[model samples]
Target: MRISAVRTADRFLPERLSRQLNPWLLRLDQMLDGSTEHAVAQRVSLIAFLVRIISAAIALVSQVIFARWMGQFEYGIFVLVWVTVVILGNLSCLGFQTTVIRFVPEYLERQQLDHLRGILFTSKAFALGLTTCIALIGAGGVYFFREAIESYYVVPFLIGFICLPMIALGDTLDGTARSRSWVLVALTPTYIIRPVLTLVVMSIAHAAGFAPTATAAVTSAIIATYTTTLFQLLVVNHRFQAVVVPGTKTIRFGEWFAVSLPIFLVEGFFFLLTNADVLMVGRYMEPDKVATYFATVKLLALVHFVYFSVKAGAAQRYSELMHTHDHAQLSQFARDTARWTFWPSLMMAIVLLLLGKPLLYLFGAQFTDGYPLLFVLVVGVVARASVGPAESLLNMAGKQKICAMVYAVTLIVNICLSIVLIPVYGLAGAACATAFSMVFEAVTLALTVYNRLNITMFVFAGRTNARPVKEEI
Candidate 1:
């Protein structure tokens, strides 16, 4: 009887051990899954996108309040100045951020630590030096036009001039963090925290006996940008060091520029393409008219953000897949990404369209006059959605030059259309031009991806083509 009892006890012991160990094994699986680079990028991008949406909501309120307080004329000046800054700031980004996203991941994958470190350092330096020079040139141009420019606009533009360096630096840091899949760390500073803090500061300033004007708002933005970027740099640097030691590899300035210049042109042309409509309106129409158009564009931007969010997540994965020549998986991932970007963006467009009138009302009754423009603008957003984040897939797969060429052509087409249409149709014509140009850009980018990678970046009929590639991922 004792021997029999011992045998039963022995058998039960193994089962007890497995029950104890299974949870730990499950935890290990999760950890391993989380460690994949694609997983990290997707997680970070989604988190960043969510945070960005919240931050953008707060900013929208502030923009409306700020615009109302400043009155239509002052508000128009502010928008013009702000748009100019945005255009220049993006151009000055010089594709370092874009270049970093591509090269950093590839280098890290190949274990080229030196090139990795060099690229990061070089990219940041390139952005700073180039943007600073550009700002100085712009300031010089402003100085030349000071007599022709408004007295109020002069000071605000000058204040905005100071913002360029930090903005450029922040963009470079953002790219670096993204490459490493540090989404919150990369985006929180520039996108979420900075805009929120700017609003807070502006509100306090208004209450504390300071005149509520574009100057105060612009000043608040500058302070917020500097503070958030500095903090981001410190935290990102610490995390950056934790992952990989700096200076373990040599810096290659030459190679970095060779890649960044074409990319810079790509980004620059795209920026020009986007801002051309607003710019032409500003040139030909009254400030009040420009304000109406600008308001509509900002409202539609929310839908566009969804597209960008998916691209943020998909880009790194696309790069990694391209490196492995995993055509089958790449095709599948691109299709899924397209579906994800499109459906959400379409839903967002619908919701925003329904709420468009009220949201425009936030800018004041006069501002709400632009509601029809929302419908025109939304068509572009949804049309772009049909194709997904085509530019990202191209830019990631070392096809940025082709993307740039496409954007350049589109920009030229947009300008020509806007010039002819704006005079004839006014705001409606401007809206039409923008929508037409955007749809063109989307179609061109989608074709570019297909031509370069042979993957369909659309939602329909993707499953039938999911056959395995000859090469492994």
Candidate 2:
């Protein structure tokens, strides 16, 4: 009997050890199988967080390779031009990217298939047409103003413009996938595939005798953008076909435009605000300095992506909850998201800062100069995370105008601060400017959410009153 009991204990020991060792797997299984709306949102956020973590690693590695290959000056030029192009590409979508997130869920919930088909088609067509026009005009502007522009930037700018239409299309498709909670499909193309492809293509170009210059880098970007966007377009279309029944397409251009325009302002200012420091640094400093600053930013990407992941997962849920008039539940979920964002962000920021110098050194020994900037920049990232995705919640609740106003004001402050600070204090000044602006943004957003939705969204806030919304969202 004693021998038999010992055998039984031995058999159960591994099972007990597995449960203790991999509790997260058990939680993941629960998240996967749970039927509640919160469960789905949680699952999406977890998946997105994991995806962003992987993408951040890929991006960091690719960037290190690029810096090693092109050196700091060329890499800096590529970074500035590419960042500018990405901001414009998102703007060229004219708010349709988020507009779809707002409307698609509503349409699906209402079983409005015609409207769904109309929006899906309209968002894509509008993004392509509008961005194409922007690209052409931008190209002409660049040519006409060529003499006035810095010579090194001119060709890269032109090459980068080629990516505009495709970038906008990719963003729209990302939103399309996000609206349906297809988190992996929404994020992978932009975050994972595009960066990897750009690296591979750039390496190929260099191997084929193309110069290791910004022009070659931008050219690789063009090819990768086109390929990734087209691939995403096809995949998104397939997903839609499987779920959405075929029917006559409705065209509500006027209505969609009305919605998209304000969102465009909100998002446009938001992107500009987000990238303003980088742009300002480029304006006031040399390429090597820009490279160092950008490298620091890249190191911080792990912390920053936590907020983005939560924002991506929470927006559509916010839209559904708002429309349902589940104010109490919405308030609770908002607080939950704030927690989700802040804790992980705070944790990652600690880890990143602890390893900051070593990580920056990976970019190159010269790049290690960026280590000091991480301390200032991380404060802003964590501050922003404290409010979760307040803008997304507002926008989804149809409070875009107010949100746009808040962002516009915040952007103005960021630009003014960057301009005033970068020339005087250099990179440290830019870091301070960005960090201060983020704090301002967070406080303002928290106030706006409380005023508009009667929900407290701060990370440390207690249970909200859940009062009735003062007006239509």
Candidate 3:
């Protein structure tokens, strides 16, 4: 009883379309439930990718308004202040936020809800206290040595302090949310709502004929940071109540600190390596030059962010795979994750580079002057993506000490190169320094992944008679 096919002028259209989409469909299938571990990683990574694109767009628009409203000098100050707050705020998480994404997922997978409850409260309390202390101490030290830092950064630096606690608080909420796969809850407030709020507030200020300086911009940032984080806190709390008991047993504070300390070092060093060039540029060059250099880095960051988003998604999977003790499955998951990181990243890099000049031009004519730096920065990004988030492999594999060492060495090299080159080659020096340091980081992460995990962390994924990476429980 075969049914007759209905014929039309477009009879084979569905078949043609499916044929065209089959590869993507197969890839999607591979990404989903190729194994439970891989599926989790792929889904989180995909969501992070989509969210970051939205975030990047919102951030780009905000910066454009910031640049126009503040003028070059004032805009440069805001960049410096904003970057400072971001680094410190992320740092102030004390590694607990990201650590939660790691340990909570693993503990929960092991049905260690008791431990998960402990981590939940412990990480938040510790991050809150630590960052608050750091901000206060930093402010005190700055007050004492007020004559030390450059004149322009003083006010901006102080203003940046209001954000550190808020940022750190937001990060903890993000980690908790992501561990549970509440992607929107984890990302939206910080990435989307915060920027939108910042821009809206600043626009209102400018509309009222305010000076619209860095101070004004920073006031807006402070408002946005607190507003979004508080909102996230309330929403996350509501969700938390449904899943976790209010009176769950808490882990020992000492135990929590012990686990987070190494992670703290790893994160601190990583932050230093990533932001060293920008910090150094601000130190050596004028504020306006910093604005240009930061703009260039942001332009090239589209590719870099892909590698990061993949890392964020895959790190948890790496941890879960380690728990399985199945070498074959672990290697397959590793290879699949790496492959996911590479080809898509390469395509995205191509697209970003093509549009980079125009985006830089969005900052204005003087802003487009740094377009040449994009090529220099892109090399590092492509090279790193070539290895497919190798750093995550090391971090999740209990090689945080080695990771710290590698970042330390790279940061020093970056600083020395930036200092030497900037005086001679200007912004090109900073770009060159950043590229070289990133290449160094990729090489270090590749070796760590290879020696520790025995997987080839590279663009090329097939067999090479690779040996298994050894580690202790």
Candidate 4:
């Protein structure tokens, strides 16, 4: 296919048309065929974007099915519980999930195989152990607080706790795989395989005479989560063997933990900030309302997934560049990532708003009420994409402490606004609070990157005149 394009360009294309098409075609060919680091990163970003697109479709279809099967109230309960669990599971890594991404590249670059082997062994063990303990404690808390909690949510929360350790392990494995730029290995299990498995398991359970309640839904999630995570564990471990043969492992517990703790704060606050709106809505509204808001949020993922795709591909490359102390390349790549993130996200956001009503109706007729909120919510998403993955660049550049501070301030603002706004404005208020918070987060992170790293990361920042950072190497 590339050859055909190249041949046509050489033989038949007019001068102006050929001039316009040739550069892009050449870059596409290189992205497909080149062996350079830049080519590899582009390929990973392209593949990750494609995977996220597929994942979004699968998720949307499955959520619509769940809503149809269980009704708004029960589906709302399930989504609330599931979102909480996912956040906790990712947090349960205590930053090791991301820490691995930072350190693994450093280890491999220095040929510190013993430390590499040690970190690989310890990160999984630590996350699994910590999360298991937390899950147990969570179960105990639920048991003790069952009297005060809503009876409908009680069973599902307990079931969600049971899935926590596996979720944590899966996340850690995902980071390990990503650190190696094994894009498919890193993404497929969590994104493609797990969602599909969850849908299949839920269908099987429903067909087997189980009621389509949140409890039943969560039980299906447990089976799917365990099965998918175990499969990922095996694959990541097997792949690691080719990278580093087993030997005497050197565990740098103090150093690893020190690095990971600040990251824990950054990631924790970031996750909470991302989901706090849904949680706040769940707190102040009925289950049906929660379902409506969640459905709206899910539809907006058409725009949201663009940032995540660019982020997933950019983080490891940023880490590599940071370690190399290549200020010029790092600055340019950061700018490139912002462009990659913003334009597609803007396009998707416009498309999502255009289709918002019909898409909401897919959930249920009542969900169309949330359509007006899309306009409010999309402002934040586009504002955020304008900075691309600025937080990622900061985190990779050893500036996570300040990044955490930025997210912390944003989260506080979100919660306070939600508290003040939700009672008065209801779901519209929640949307307003979230959108404002996202805009605040984006502005702060972009400013922080520029101040700390001397890198102009905004999507619209002029490339030719980008400020140069001091070289650390």
The TM-score values for the models, in the order shown, are 0.89, 0.94, 0.92, 0.96
Off by over 4 Å in 3: 1-35, 464-468
> How close is each model in CA RMSD to the real structure?
7.4, 4.3, 3.9, 2.0
**Tens digits of per-residue lDDT for model 2 on 304-369?**
899999988899899999889999999999999999999999999999999999998888999988
Lowest lDDT sum, 10 consecutive residues, model 2, at 1-10
lDDT of 2: 0.91
- Number of backbone collisions per candidate: 1, 0, 0, 0
Ordered list by TM-score, greatest first? 4, 2, 3, 1
lDDT of 4 by residue, 172-242 (tens): 99899999989899999988998899999999988999999999888888898999999999999999889
How much is 364 displaced in model 1, in angstroms? 0.2
lDDT values, one for every candidate: 0.79, 0.91, 0.79, 0.91
Residue 141's lDDT in candidate 4: 95
Pairs of residues clashing in candidate 1: 114-249
